[model samples]
Target: MYTETPAVVMRQIKTVNGRRMIVLFSRKYGKISAGTSISESGKNKSALALRPYTYGRYELSKVKDNFYINGAEVLRSYYRIGEDVDKYLQASYVLEFTDKLLPEGEPAEALFDLLTEFLSMMEERKQAYGTLVLGYLCQAIAWSGSAPDLGVCSGCKDAEVKYFSVKDGGLLCEDCAGKAVQDRRLIFPVTVDIIDVFNYLLESPLKSLHALALREDLEKKVRNILRSYIAYHLGIEELKSESLIV
Candidate 1:
């Protein structure tokens, strides 16, 4: 069977036989691995569409249980993201992060749109790349249905919360935090600023992130907390592109 759909190139790997296996997040099929002999270096539209960070329409032939790329055309190529090392690394990290969140054969249309919007915004961003990354992370977690509780304390449902508990899966009130687990690593003390930022990121659209500037210190703190939270709840311990970001 032959099918065509809008897809984002998540990553590519080379097989021992020299064929490139492309991991694509498609609108019709969530995540899929398709083998292709098409050379990315070729001076053709299909070749250009095969590289990472390119959003394109792909034509694939499914034989029994495997998929092979027959052709493709770029819809939008975030080629400029590669111009700066910082942007490149951050963009790469987002792709890796998104890849980890996606499951095979399930359609995630909302996330597909979010990923494309993130790439579009990241391509034109000049500074505070981490802020954008943080926003994307928060929104992605929400899309995955594992978003941390922010409205009230996850433990006791108290209105006054001071910490974010990864194990408890959300905000923690002062009283609850006092009686929670002894593992200090599972609890992160949060200020009003941090809570406000999390709420904003989760509630606002990705396009508005360009105007928001989060303090450098705050960004790092939130990133660390989110890293730990995702690791515990999602079972994603590491991302190769994460180290490449900074």
Candidate 2:
């Protein structure tokens, strides 16, 4: 059986047998793995499509429950992301995070689009990479159905929010904030601007995020906020590629 799907190469791991196993996040089949003997010598048609950061249509053949990449055509490589160290590292983190969070064989169409948009934009982006990354992180979390509520206080619901509680999964009202202290929940005061920016990132499209502006210091803060939230919720201690941002 053969199938074709739109996919992005999330990763490529080399097997002991010298073949490459590509982990693809596909629009149709979600996350999947297929082995290919495609060499990177520019002689194989599937080689470029199999490289990480390449988005393309992948043709796969199924044999005894395993899939092999029969052929592929690269749509957008986003290869420029490798031109700069900062872009390369952050972009790598984006793919790493996506690979880590999404479950195999579960299709998330919105997430697939979001990732493609993110990679496309990242390729040409010089500034606002941090903001773009934060936006992607927020959208990815939301798409995964683990988004923290940003509207009402997650604790008291109706009260005005004063702080964000990672343990509670969202903002908390003053009353709830005091209670959280007693219960030893980790909480941090949130500025209105931070809330507004985060809300915008969560609701806006990836293209709009390219023009989004924030003071340099605030950008770092927001990055930490989303990173901490993801780490707490997803159990990811730290992204390996995060060091390049600083």
Identify the candidate with maximal TM-score: 1
Each model's RMSD to truth, in Å?
Answer: 1.3, 1.9
Highest lDDT among the candidates is held by which one? 1
Write candidate 1's Cα lDDT for 99-184 as tens digits.
88888879999999999999999999989999999999999999988888788898778899899999988899998998986588
Candidates' lDDT values, in order? 0.91, 0.84
Q: Distance (Å) between predicted and true CA of 216, model 2?
A: 1.7
What global local distance difference test value does model 2 have? 0.84
Candidate 1 ranges with C-alpha deviation above 4 Å: none
Q: What is the lDDT of residue 36 in candidate 1?
A: 98
lDDT of 2 by residue, 49-88 (tens): 8888999999999898688998999998887998988888
Give the CA lDDT, 0 to 100, for residue 9 in model 2: 92
